[model samples]
Target: MTSKVDRPPTYEDALQHPKYEPNQLHPGSVESQPPSYSPGSGMYSSSPPSYWAQAGMWSVPDLPPSGMPTAVPTLSGGLPATNPGEMEGSFSSQWETTSVRHSFIRKVYLILAAQLTVTFSVVAVFTFVDPVKMFVIKYPGIYWASLVVYFMVYCILLCCKEPRRRFPWNLVLLGVFTVALSYMSGTISSYYETKAVLLAMGITAVVCVTVTVFCFQTKVDFTSCGGFLCIASILLVIIGAVTAIVLSFHYVPWLHMVYAAIGAIIYTLFLVYNTQLLIGNRELAISPEDYIYGALSLYIDIVHIFLFVLQISGSATE
Candidate 1:
């Protein structure tokens, strides 16, 4: 114990000491060794190579190159990239086209209404003018001529590419011709009874309006009735012609009245059927010519109803 504090340890004794042993040092301890410096290298040597630079590849630029603008890829041969604004504009154009189509349909209906008004006014004038003494003709030649002209005009309208353009003029002319012809026909007999004619007209008007309204309101398809009604109509016409031919040998008032009544019923059905077809059948996609055809059908119904009522009433009086 007196000898331990006497002197310092030797180099070999210091190396063998517990403080200088490797097992006693910390796990991550590094030796204090200075790196050797090259003579030519400065304080700031060359920077480490980047990953892409080391691989000899060009790195993408932040922005397009100065003189070389970025090119947008093309689609089909001449088609450009789809822009949202252009797509919206195209949709707007389609909507506008549909609006125009609907507008055209409205105009067509307006024109039809105007034409009907003109026709009715002409008929009214003829009915009220009191031309029984002034415009008498024996053979009803004017009526036949008017019918021929009307049929010709209808054919032209049917065949023409732009029928609407011709419709107004044709309708006006037809109205005038019908009025003139009606006046001529009514004047043929001095025994023209205005009250009876008016009654017939009123009945026809009531029936036509009622049936048309009902058909429109119901919107029921009556196309199925076409075949049956057509066959019946043809039969009625044949019977009427044959009866007229046989009237020389026999006068049958009851038979005539019966025929008239039957004809009236048939015509009533025709009116309802045609109107229902007009209102309900999308397949009917009617044109202006089809409107005229419908008008003609209704007119025929009115005429037949008038004739039947007149005959029935006259026979009853007799």
Candidate 2:
């Protein structure tokens, strides 16, 4: 052994090495081809191309050929791909929701128009007819009968299933009955008292419109006050009943007038609170039936406020 050192290959010698240009050396020689290399393995000894390098060619791995099985793209672990149909379906669902909301709003406005027409017509007829004297003198029974009928209708609405189905026709009938009875009561009390009723109506209209506009514009939530207001209403009703009974024994007209003024103020507060709920709260998403209920609540508030204001103003005129 002479212990001679082995020399390093020159660049030209390295270029001609068997490992260099393996594909070219094995061109058209299938038997001399290099073994297949896995990604990330050191066997290839070269960096992979940038993903953007193959701009037009198929980038997804293991995708089937176009003519064979349909190719589906997925994330790692193979979840199904998002398709155009799914996107379209989502959009359609959103549109349907919006349409339903618009339809609900339209129905509410239609019903509100009908109610206002009925109410205003009744009030106008009563103003002209002036039947209170005849009702009071000849048909004293009418007052009690009207009260009974109103109570029955209230009960029916509270007890019935699908109360909305009966609402339209029942409201029409009630409007007619109420207008007749109210006309009789107002006229018999005094024809001059009609001016008081008109004044009350004007005040109520102004207050309702103003508060409703404020509620709609501000969009402030007032549902939290609902429970307190309801409790206050019950207490007011009880107090009113007791006071009426006591006043009837004493025949104190002035005390009755004072109560009327107080009642009007309470009812106006109710209108403000209820309007806030309708325009401000998410509970407004309730069905048309609920909208009717809300309208009825506000209607009661307005009507009571008007009656009390009329009674107080009439007493002042007397």
Candidate 3:
């Protein structure tokens, strides 16, 4: 009989015959465990790596050693793993915020344009229509009545947030306010000659456009001037009252002209201030949620500017 020779198991045999858990006491398992770097200090372990099984032993896929760090998990190209979704979500959130602000700006301006269109239309009818102009002039009480209505609605919209933000109610209130203000504005415009009114309108348009463009581009933040602007407004009102009282006793043409010029300049500054408030990312900005208030503020600024310009132009022409 020829002597038989034993050979190492093939990869297939290693797979088909994995070591049993109970066979842990076997010398192959004991020897397969890592060795200490030094017999004394177990700081480092040495062994044929766990993936290298002895000739007779078989095993399953190797796991990272309990204490040692294994090959760092990576993407297919060996690049470090990262979360695309998290990065994508961050960008999307920023984009959504920006889009919302832009939409809010558009909504406010659209509402403002509609208001100006309605107001100027009424002014045109009152100025051009002889019968309507004569009738409105005959009944100056109509202007007073509109003033009363405008004052009441303005108070409600400004003093109460709920009325300003409420859906159909807000729109209804705003419409009423717009009509009342339109009548008052028309009455004021009627007091001036047609040429004076037209000239004032042209100048007012140019000034408003220029101020709006400046507010958008200039680094000088007008929003921060709210305190100063408010003070200036109160002082203007006081000076105006004084001027009116003085004129009541004795009309001074130069004083009146000076007052009108001051009013125009002050309200033009107000236009710049209010326009800055409309823009977002400022130290002081109107909230996106209160687009109605934004439009109301801008509309008031424009109307006041127009009236003051009309006063100055009328005085100049006279």
Clashing residue pairs in candidate 1 (N, C-alpha, C atoms within 3 angstroms): none
lDDT of candidates 1 onward, in order: 0.56, 0.59, 0.80
C-alpha lDDT (0 to 100) for residue 2 of candidate 3: 27
Q: Which candidate do you rate higher for TM-score, 1 or 2?
A: 2
How many steric clashes between backbone atoms does each model show? Answer: 0, 1, 0
> How well does model 2 score by local distance difference test?
0.59
Screening candidate 3 with a backbone cut-off below 3 angstroms (N, C-alpha, C), the clashing residue pairs are: none
Q: How far is candidate 1 from the true structure (C-alpha RMSD, Å)?
A: 16.8
Report the lDDT tens digits of candidate 3 across residue range 178-266. Answer: 99999999988887788888998899899989998888898887788888888989989999999999999998878887888888888
Candidate 1 vs candidate 2: which has greater lDDT?
A: 2
Which structure is stronger by lDDT: 1 or 3? 3
Question: What's the TM-score of every candidate structure?
Answer: 0.53, 0.65, 0.76
lDDT per residue for candidate 1 within 249-317, as digits (tens), equals: 898888878887888888899877765544534444344335544444455455556567766655655
Model 1 segments beyond 4 Å from truth?
Answer: 1-140, 147-177, 180-192, 280-285, 288-290
The true-versus-predicted C-alpha distance at residue 230 of model 2, in Å, is 1.8
What is the lDDT for 241 in model 1? Answer: 91
